[model samples]
Target chain A: MDNYNYASFPLDMDDAVFGAFRTQAPAAGDPAPDGPVTDLATGQRAPLSALWRSGPAVIEFGSYT
Target chain B: MEDLAARLGPRGFAFAFLYVREAHPGELAGHHATFAGKCDLARRLRDRWQIARPILVDDLDGPLHAAYGMLPNMTYIVGQGGRVLYRAMWTDAASIEWACDYLQREAQERRTSKRVAPFYSELRGFRAHDQYARIFMNGLLEGGGRRAADEFVAATEATEGRAAADRLRAARQELPEARP
Candidate 1:
């Protein structure tokens, strides 16, 4: 098991102000925050670091209302 | 996303959806006030949408969502080293597919490449769900929904332009009731 501290990750949510609407994505080579997220299929809590371990990952952030 | 996953999974590409707060909460699946409530709604959404990819639920406060632009629908591509390669404000399959292709080429070249410029394409006459749209549109015409719509429109106008914002508002008038 790997212990990861999310606080160390360079995550700046404030820069992503909703109405500002960034035309560009986060810059390449910028490290992504390995925050805690729940896997709905297995009902297990894991950091994003666990998900992108193998290779490239495509993540879609959304809600089903 | 599933289609992209299927096509790219064999090529060392992984796909997943990070379920955030409700986009349009109503009687069927109302807003989640607690972490547990959000988890329950996430399960329901996975089942309802028949989502094939793994669904990850964000915390009640939605730190992940806020970190990634806080949009209702956003797409991101992370490279091998947990670096964000591409991002889209809205979920557009075509643009995403193009990004994937670009990534594949970059991977083959075995070199760190420049970020692909963002592309926007407005799909005319695209409908998510007639039944759901009717309910959501009706909801948007009301109190909280109206405010959300206004805010979204203003945001769009500020970002994209008034024409784009007005088009989004016009979408409300086109919603049709579900077939009986």
Candidate 2:
């Protein structure tokens, strides 16, 4: 799914759709992909690598909606 | 999450909440149009949810989110050197705490015996679904506005959706805290 296109709310997240999204994702033992992220504390942009640089990171991806 | 951070942070685990695409976009919580807008929404989320963990806001269009599977509330425990240790479909604090503990034990074992190495495995992680679904929907509606409830009712049937709203209206503890 394109990141921009939300495909609307209450999506038909059936077993197949969930499987496609889950199976294609990065899995255990794979190198975590690094990208840009804005650290909320300083309100400054930073690389995703920064969060993990200090130690093992537990990242929970989400949003308000 | 705060308690987990307090207990495990000292043990060298850094916890974060990565802000991503809005799951249910509506008037109040629309699609991320700009980076600043997304950050503001993220800040509001952190404040409203009372999440103490550092909130990392993903860029608009969310390339990072797409690459990581784009699940709404997925949890990932990434170990040192950027190796993924555990990836669960949903964030379950208890299960995550157990994983952290397991990782700690694994590191100790590795110190004693050099045979320990990262390996691939999967499991069906569970979440407190029934009531939490209601809670999650309430959040979506809060941010997304009235249309959120309307679409939800249309999709899940007005009876089912109204039942949830009624329960929420007659609520006691909406956000249940789990303490160790």
The prediction achieving the highest lDDT against the true structure is: 2
Tens-digit lDDT track of model 1 for A1-65: 02111111112322444445464335445677669998887879989767779888888887754
lDDT, candidate 2, equals 0.76
Question: Which tens-of-lDDT digit does each residue in B49-71 have in candidate 1?
Answer: 68898889887787777677667
Q: What is the TM-score of chain B alone in each candidate?
A: 0.66, 0.80
Best by the TM-score measure:
2
Give the per-residue lDDT of model 2 (tens digit) for B17-110. 9999887777777777778888888988888889899899887888898888878888898887898888888888898999999988888888
Could you give the DockQ of candidate 2? 0.62
In model 1, how many backbone clashes occur?
A: 0
Candidate 2 per-residue lDDT, tens place, A1-65, comes to 35473635643543433566667888988889899888888988888878778778999998887
lDDT of 2 at B176: 35
